[model samples]
Target: MALGVWSPSLIDVVLFVIAAVVVWKLERRRRRGWATGRLPPGSEGLPVVGETLQLIAAYKSENPEPFIDERVRRHGRLFTTHVFGERTVFSADPEFNRMVLGAEDRTVEGSYPSSLSTLLGTHSLVVMKGARHKRMHSLTLARLTSPTAIREAKLLLHIDRLVRRTLDSWASSSLVLLLDEAKKITFELTVKQLVSYDQRKWIESLRREYLLLINGFFSIPFPSFLSFTTYGRALKARRKVEEALKEVIRKRKLEKATTRFDVDVNESQNNKKKKDMLEELLEGEAEGMTDEAVVDFLLSLLVAGYETTSTIMTLAVKFLTDHPRALAQLREEQEGIRKKKKDEEAALDWDEYKSMPFTQCVINETLRVVNIIGGVFRRAKTELHFKGYTIPMGCKVFLSFRAVHLDNEYFDDARTFDPWRWQKNAAAQQVGGPTVYTPFGGGSRLCPGYELARVVISVFLHYLVTRFNWEEAEKDRLVFFPTTRTLKSYPINVRRREEEEGA
Candidate 1:
C-alpha cells in the first residue's frame, strides 16, 4: 500500500513538470516573435505591473521629459513599453504624432485605460469617436466658440467680478499661494459657465471631490471597498458629483417640460431665457440625447476646463515675475485695453478681448513651456507602420506633446519662456502646415473649450496685471508628474498697482 501511494504522487509531480515546460516554451516563442519581427524595442518590465511605477515617477519628477528622453536615447523615438497593464508605444516624433492625430479612425482609435474610462463615464466626449464624436464636437463647438456665443456669454465681466472678489479677500494677507487661489477662481468660473449655478454654495465641496477624482485618474487600479483606497475614493467622489448633477439636470428637465406648450416662448420669472451651457445641453436632450450623456459631457468639460486653466494661469504669473521685460510688455498691452475702458469696473467686451495680441502670445508661451497636457493617448486599431517600424494592433500610443513643444528642432531656444517667440513666424509655423504646436491637440479631437480657456486666461491676466503687482514670496518650485502644479501652492507677495506706483 505504501509503494502504490508513492508511485501515484511521483506521477502527479511528473505531470506538473511537463505542463510547466510547455508554458515556458510558449512564452519564449511569443517573446521571440515580439523581438524578431514587428514590435518596437524596449522592456515591458515585469508582468502585471509593467513600467507603471517608473512612468509615474517620471511624471512626478522636476524634469518630466527625461522619462521619454532616456527611453528615446535607448530605443529611438517610437518604442514599446508596458504601461497601465498593456503594451504601449510612446512616439516623441512630432511629424508622426501630427499624422496619427490627423488620421483619427482611419489608422487608430481614441482609447484610455479602463480606470480612466470608468472614471470619465461611458458617454464622455473623451471616448466618443467617428460620427458621434463629430456631432458632439459640433454641438459643443457651436456653443463654446461661435461669435454669437462669445458675445452673449459675457465671460470677461463675470470673470473680472470674480477676480476682484478673490483679490479683495486676499488683500489683508501678505502672502498668497497663487496656484491654490487660481484653482478656486477657475473652478468657480467653470461651474458658473457650465450650469449658471451660484458657486459660493457648492465650490468647496466640488473642489474636494474633484481633487480625489483627479488623483485617482493616475493612481494604480486596485480593488478595494474602503474609502481610503484611491479607486474607492474616486468612485465615492464620482457618486457625489453624479448625485449633485442629477438634481440640477432634473430641475432643468422639469423646467423644459413645463414650458413645452406655451404659445409665447417660456422664460424665467425675470422674463429672460436661460443662458448657461447646461440649458443648451438640455435643449439637445429634448431633441433626443440621454441624461447620462449630458452629465458625462459636463463632467468632462469641468475636467478639461479648470485645472489646465489654473495651472497655466499660475505659470503665467511665475514666468512674468521672473522676466520683468515680458511682464512690462504684458502690462503695456493690458493697460492699453484698460485705458480704452471708461473705468476699472467697465466690462471687457469681445472686441477688446480679441485685440490683445500680446496677451494671446503670453498665453501660448505659457502653454508651451509648462506643457500642461504632457501627452495625448491613442490606441492602434490595426497594425501601424511608420518610420520603418511596426506598431502592433491595439497597442497604446502616447503622442508626447512635451517632446514636440520643447524640441530645439522646432523652436529656437525652446527652453526659454519668450512670449515674443510666438509674435514671430516661429510659433505660428508650428500651428500651420504639419501642425507641430498642439497645445489644445489637433484634428477633429481638438479641445472644444480651447477658445473658452483662452478667454479665461486672458481675462485673469488682465485683472491680475492691471490691478495687483505680485512677486515670488520665496524661491518657488514646481512638479510636472501626474499633472503640472507648484511644489507648494506657489506663494507670492501681492501689493496693489497703486501702491507699487507710489512706492
Candidate 2:
C-alpha cells in the first residue's frame, strides 16, 4: 500500500466510521429530548436506515421470531425499534397492546408508513382520522355488509365461476404455486365485487402494476428520479391504477344515469337489481361524497378485500397439507355439507357459510399461525405511560399480535398448527381474553371487512377441500417480513377429486 495515497477500501472504511459517529450523535440528541420520561428500552439503529434492514431481514427469514425474541430478551416485552422511518414502541405484551388498541384516537390514532399513505392516496380509509374516518368507515361497512348488498346472486355466481376457472387452470399443471393462484382469484373477485369491472381484459397489466405499487409500500422513502427508482415505479403504477379506476367510475356513473331514466324506481325495485360496491358509492356520491373519496375508497377496498384474505387462504392449504388429520377432518366437514346439498354447483349461501363451525376453526387457526397482519401502527396523541415507561406524545406504537398469538403464555403449544385448539373447551380456546390473539386487529380501527374476509376464505376452502387434493411439491420456504408469505410462492401439486379417486 502506498503511504501517501488513499485506497478505495480505506476511503469506504473512513466514510463508514464517520457515518457511525454522526448517527450515534443524532440518536443521543434525540434520546436526550425524551429523557424527561422513562422511555422503552431499545435501539433506533443507524442514521436514515435505522433498524429497518434488520426488521425486513427477519421478515424475509423463515423464522422471524428471533428478531422480536432477541429484542424481548434485551428490553422485555415492551421495547422500541425504528421501523418504516418512525421511532416505534413495539409491544409484545398482550395487556399493553390491548390498552393501545382500545385507546385508539384517545391517547393514540392510526398511523402508517409514508409509502402506504402515498400509494393508497391522501384520502385512503387506512390513513383517514377523526370524523372523516368515522363517516367513511360507517358508509363503507354499510355498503359491504348490508343484508341486501351481500345477497347478490350474480356476485356469488361470479365468485363460483372465478374459483372454478382458477382451479381448472391449475389442473393441467404438474406444479401450482398457491400464492400466485390465490392472488388471481382474489384480484378478480375484488374487482368484480367492488367495481363490477371484468378484470380478464386488463388483469395481466394491472396485476403487474399493482405489484409495483405494493413493493413501493416497503421501499425506502427515496426520491424518484426520472421514474426509474422503486418509488418512482410505484408512483407511476399508482397513477395508472387511479386512471383506470377513475375511468370505470365515470362509466358506471353514466350507466347509472342511463338506467335511472330507462326504468321507474318502483319497477326497478321490484326486480332483483344487482348492486355492487361501486353502485353504492355512486349513490353516496349523489348524496354529496366527493369523487376523490370514492376513488380512495375503491383503492383501499381492493387491498383490504384481497391481499390478506388471499394470503390466509393460501396458508390454509399449506397448514392443512402439513397436518393430515386436520385435513381429513376438514374434508369430512366440507364433504358432509356438499353431500347434503341438492345442487353440487350451488354456491355456499350466507347461512351455509355460517353452519361450517369446523371450517371457521380452520380459518381462525390459520390466522393465528400465519399472522398476516404483523401489527397495527398508531401514534400517541399525548404523553402516555405503560408499564412504568413513557411514550412521549407523537411516538409511534406497533401492537405486535404476532408475538402475542405465538406466546406460550397466551396460547399453549402456540407454535403448532392445531385447529382443534379453537374447539370448545380446548386449552387454546380458553386462553384468549378480549384482545388476546387478535389477528384481525382490535377496537374501532379493526378491519371492517373481517366478516367478509372470513366468508371469502371459507367459501374458497369449501370448494378447495371438496373438489381437489393438494400435496406440496417442495418444503415451504416461508417469509415473515413485511408480510407472511412464501419465498417461492409455495408450490404444490394439486389433483381434482375425481382424478385422485381414480388414481
lDDT of 1 by residue, 1-503 (tens): 89987997697689867865775566456556556347768888865457888987877777767777889889987888877766788888887888898889888889877777788888888888888888878877787555566667666678778877888887799799998999998898888878888757677888888888887886655554657788889988988888888888898878767667553453454355557779877655325767777888888878888888888888888989989999999999999999878876777778888999998888888888887777788988777888778776656898888887888888789888888987786444543246778888887888777777888788888888888888888986687666664455888998888877998
lDDT of 2 at 211: 84
Model 2's C-alpha root-mean-square deviation from the true structure amounts to 4.5
Q: Give the clashing pairs for model 2.
A: 59-481
The global C-alpha lDDT for each of the candidates, from Candidate 1 onward, is: 0.79, 0.79
The estimated TM-scores of all candidates read: 0.88, 0.88
Model 1 scores a C-alpha lDDT of 0.79
lDDT of 2 at 412: 77
